[model samples]
Target: MSAVLDVVLSSAFLAAVLRVSTPYLLAAFGGLVAERAGVSNIALEGQMLSAACTGALVAGYSGSVALGALCGVGVATLLGLLLAALRLELGADVIIAGIGLNLLASGGTAYAVFTLLDDKGGTSGLKSGSLPAVPLPGIDSIPLLGDVISGQNMVTWLAFLTAPVIAWLFYRARFGFHLRAVGEMPDAAASVGIPVRRVQYTGLALSGALAGLAGVFLSMGYVSFFVRDMTAGRGFIALAAVFLGGLRPWGVFLAALGFGAAEALAVQLGTLDVPPQLVSTIPYAMTLVALAVYAWRRRRQAGVEVAASV
Candidate 1:
């Protein structure tokens, strides 16, 4: 017990939390953006998986990390546009279309990997390098703070910055106002001459880009190689964070951070005399509990509204 507490209290644990939370933060914000645009991007999982695979393969073959990251993000943005088109042009159900995209990404990435590398596992055989880490010279000299913040992956720094950037976008930007207005009432927004469809399309593209960044981080920043389904369920977990955070930027940031902390704790506990299986389940279990609490709060709010109306 004391040992566990010590581990949790250490600066290393804080750093681990930031590292683990990077993908979650990015993906959750992606979902939040799409949701605010009145489109639920359930294909976040697919986007992350596809991006991870694409980034690794591109980097490995081209020997250019920048180009690889660009291609990966481009692919995800295209997927987002694809989702928007399916919904807007074909009148297809967004949820169903997103699910289809997810499935397609899962199968498509795996096939691409096997076809190119002849490996069923992943791009482990490739020599793809990792993204550069940012070393804060002066900051690194600080005791606990330096230990926690210095020498993190560039993606990790971007992940932390995204929270504030998104907040500014949501409240202080013109596009954000349009996005919110369109989401709240498309008919009204259109009546006022706002291009509803265009805004939605843009929002979804941004969402995909953010998720793609998360995916790239997994393969190119978290490690030098990609694994099949390396995203594991981070996209879905990030979606949960979006809702659990009340669909707000800062709220989503905290929610994602909390999830990251849980996962980090689980990893730390694994080194202890704990059951590996039980420790691994901690993050998922927390997700379930969070969902349950959110649902109950929503139901209670609904009941209160009904009573007030009555």
Candidate 2:
């Protein structure tokens, strides 16, 4: 209990939670957009992994964060388009395509990194450039809040700001309407003369762009270099966040924060007297708990509806 309180009271722990959650937030948002558009984009893991390597490699060679991010987004989006083409045009199953893409990314990144820098591990040897960090000017003057809010990586701040923008886009914009229509009722949307495939493609592209940024943030902003499989299942966690949030943007944001806190707690606990094995299970335990609770509520709601109908 004291250890938990210590972590909660520590400013560094709060900051770690934000940092750990950043990739999840970005990836969850991407998954949310794609899922909302009915894409079932399980390939977010692959997309992020691919972008991490590409972003690191490009930034190392070019020495510019901007171009690195742009290239990363482009590569990841192309991968997304390819997945769409495979699933839509060639009749491939979405899950299969996603898994295949992940395998491809894992192998391809290893080979590319080895060829570029003779390292199968990652881009740690390369002089890769990182995205700039920015401090909130006035917020830094505050007491406890300043430590939590200020001096985050630029992409971290962007991820937070992007939530409202995406929400507004969904609630206000015509493109959002089209995407939602295509997602919710493809047959009806088609009947209305909406080119369903095109809209689906656009949705995936947007999702890919966001996932690419997450990858870029992982390598360029989070760590300043690429590592093999460094995403460490954050992509899958983002998918979990998508479901946990009921595909709502703000809901997913909160869920991501929870997972981040769990992760940060695990890190903190690792340094304490607790068993290492027990400490390592904290994050996964949190995931299981969240899912179990969600399942229970869903079943309860269905049972109530059936009872009322009877």
Candidate 3:
């Protein structure tokens, strides 16, 4: 128990939390954006998987990390637009379409890797380079502060910045007002000339871009290559964070951070005498508990609203 406390209290563990939570923060914000636009993007998993695979392959082949990241984000943005088209134009169920996209991404990425690299596992043979880490020179000299915040990957920095940027967008931007209005009541927003479909499309595109950044970080920042199904349901976990945070930017930020901390704790606990299996389940277990609490609160709020109406 003392050993565990020491690990938790260390700066290294705090740094690990930031690193592990990067994808969750980015993807959760993506989910939040789509949710606020009145369209649920169930394709977040697919987008992340696709972007990770695409980013790795592109960087490996083109030898330009910037180009690969851009292509990866572009591909994810297209997937977002496709999801919106399916929901809005074809009248397809967003959930079903999103599931279909997820399946396609799973199969498609594996097949591409197999066909291109002739490997079933991943792009281990390919020399896909990792994104650069930012080293804060002055801050890096500070003892504990440097240990916690100095040499993180660029995406980790972006992930932290995203929370504040999203808050500004949500509370202070004109588009945010339209997005929230459309999400709460689309028909009413349209009656007031809000260009409902356009806003939804843009929101979904932004959502995909954010998720794509997360995916790119998975392959490019987290590691140097892509692995099959490497996202490992992080996308869904991020979706949970969106609801867990009450679909607000800062709330989602904290929820995603908590998930990250849980995962980091699980990793640290592995070095202890703890069972590896139990430790690995920590993040998912927390997700279930969070969702249950959110559901209960929502139900209670609805009950209160009904009583008030009566």
lDDT of 3 by residue, 1-310 (tens): 8999999999989999999999999999999999999999999999999999999999999999988899888989999999999999999999999999999999999999999999999998999898999999899999899999999999999999999999999999999999999999999999999999999999999999999999999999998899999999999999999999999899999999999999999999998999999999999999999999999999999999999999
Q: Which residue pairs come into collision in candidate 3?
A: none
Off by over 4 Å in 1: none
Clashing pairs in 1: none
lDDT per residue as tens, model 2, 110-185: 9999998998899988888888888888999888788987888999998888789888878899888888898999
C-alpha TM-score for every candidate: 0.98, 0.96, 0.98
Ranking, lDDT, top scorer first: 3, 1, 2
Q: Rank the candidates by TM-score, best first.
A: 1, 3, 2
Please report, as a residue range, the 10-residue window in candidate 3 with the lowest summed lDDT. 66-75
Ten contiguous residues with the weakest lDDT in model 2: 1-10
Q: Which stretches of candidate 2 lie over 4 Å from their true place?
A: none
Candidate 1 positional error at 13, Å: 0.9
Judged by whole-model lDDT over C-alpha atoms, candidate 2 comes out at 0.88
- lDDT score, residue 101, model 3? 94
